[model samples]
Target: MKFKRYASSFLLQIALAFFILSCGNSAEKKAAEESNTETTSVETKQKTILFFGNSLTAGYGIDQDDSFAGLTQARIDSLGMDYKVINGGLSGETTAGGLSRLDWFLEDEPSIFVLELGGNDGLRGIQLSETKSNLLAIIDKVRAKYPNTKIILAGMQIPPNMGQEYTEEFKAIYPDVAKEKNVTLIPFLLEGVAGMPELNLPDGIHPTEAGHKIVLETIWPYIQAKL
Candidate 1:
């Protein structure tokens, strides 16, 4: 009886030790998996450059991939950049509309912000002061959200039908904003593509695929400098 009791006690001790060791191994494995997951999340988080604008930035009638922003993304990939380009464009979006939604996009905390709005405001003949105010507000909001973020303002122009005075005023808005905000400026977003029938689509407003290539060329230098 004494021998049997001693044998039973020894077996129980062995079982308890095995159980404790198994639990320790499981906890260690779980901790390793969690650490790996956290490392992957940090490694995959890329810095972002946000392009915010109207249909011109949205690629209008063309495929989204053909837009200047998309082409810019391809260029970034080709150059093996660690930045992600986000096209935050919408068709027929006005300065006011952009102003209202600017906060939403800013939530992502972009490293660089390309402001391309106000074209629709110009086309619609909205007051230049109002346009300027909205744009200034956007810049202020972006600065508030990301104080160190680099900002690029794309200049836009209205057609002569809007009258030479209005057109000139519209053309001056971008450079003026860039000066006041102390931001970089792309002299004219549509420069070579604007007046050329071959470069524009049927609407003569948005750029065709070929035109977007030109647009890319115009802005690439400025963007490269920023990057």
Candidate 2:
């Protein structure tokens, strides 16, 4: 009887040990699975779309939320696209200024970069050659950093006050750059918004909130095409 009891007790102990080890293995597997799931979630968050430009892009003279960039983001979100739009615009930013800071923005590795500069340069009556050179350099740096990034050049026009010759050349810069770089071109960023008294603010330079909506419409087609 004593021997039998000892054998039974040993078997029970062995069975308990096996059950404990099995539970531990299951717990470890569950933990590893959760960790993998968390990693995947982080990896699949969203891609970035960067808008690099001047006051027009920065939504100068209006609420930032009412800017074209913000409106565009709202539209994108409504469509459930996995993209995050970043407004890298600065008020009164010239092409030279943009070029100087382009390297810092390139670090973000945006999937799409919308170039909207040179308007300020034109307004300031900066030399057309210098403006074009700065813009070209900016594009080159962007290409070097993100080879596969899609570039959208937003064309801008200045008032004819700077002389018809300067105006024409300044206006041509965008299309020329787009053609040369083989990037997508937004023919005219302020196409419908420009010269419309109702669309513009008192300054007649920056667009009003209503104007930004039109701006969004102007660029939406190009942006959609890339997606």
- Pick by lDDT: which candidate is best? 1
- TM-scores, all candidates, are 0.90, 0.86
Give the clashing residue pairs of candidate 1, or none: none
The backbone clash count of each candidate, in order, is 0, 0
* Per-residue C-alpha lDDT of model 2 across residues 74-144, encoded as one tens digit per residue: 99999999999999999989999999888888776888999999988988899999999998898999999
Q: What is the lDDT of candidate 2?
A: 0.92
lDDT of 1 at 87: 94
lDDT of 1: 0.93
Alpha-carbon lDDT, every model: 0.93, 0.92
Candidate 1 ranges with C-alpha deviation above 4 Å: none
Which residue pairs does candidate 2 place in steric collision? none
The prediction achieving the highest TM-score against the true structure is 1
Model 2: CA > 4 A from native: 1-31
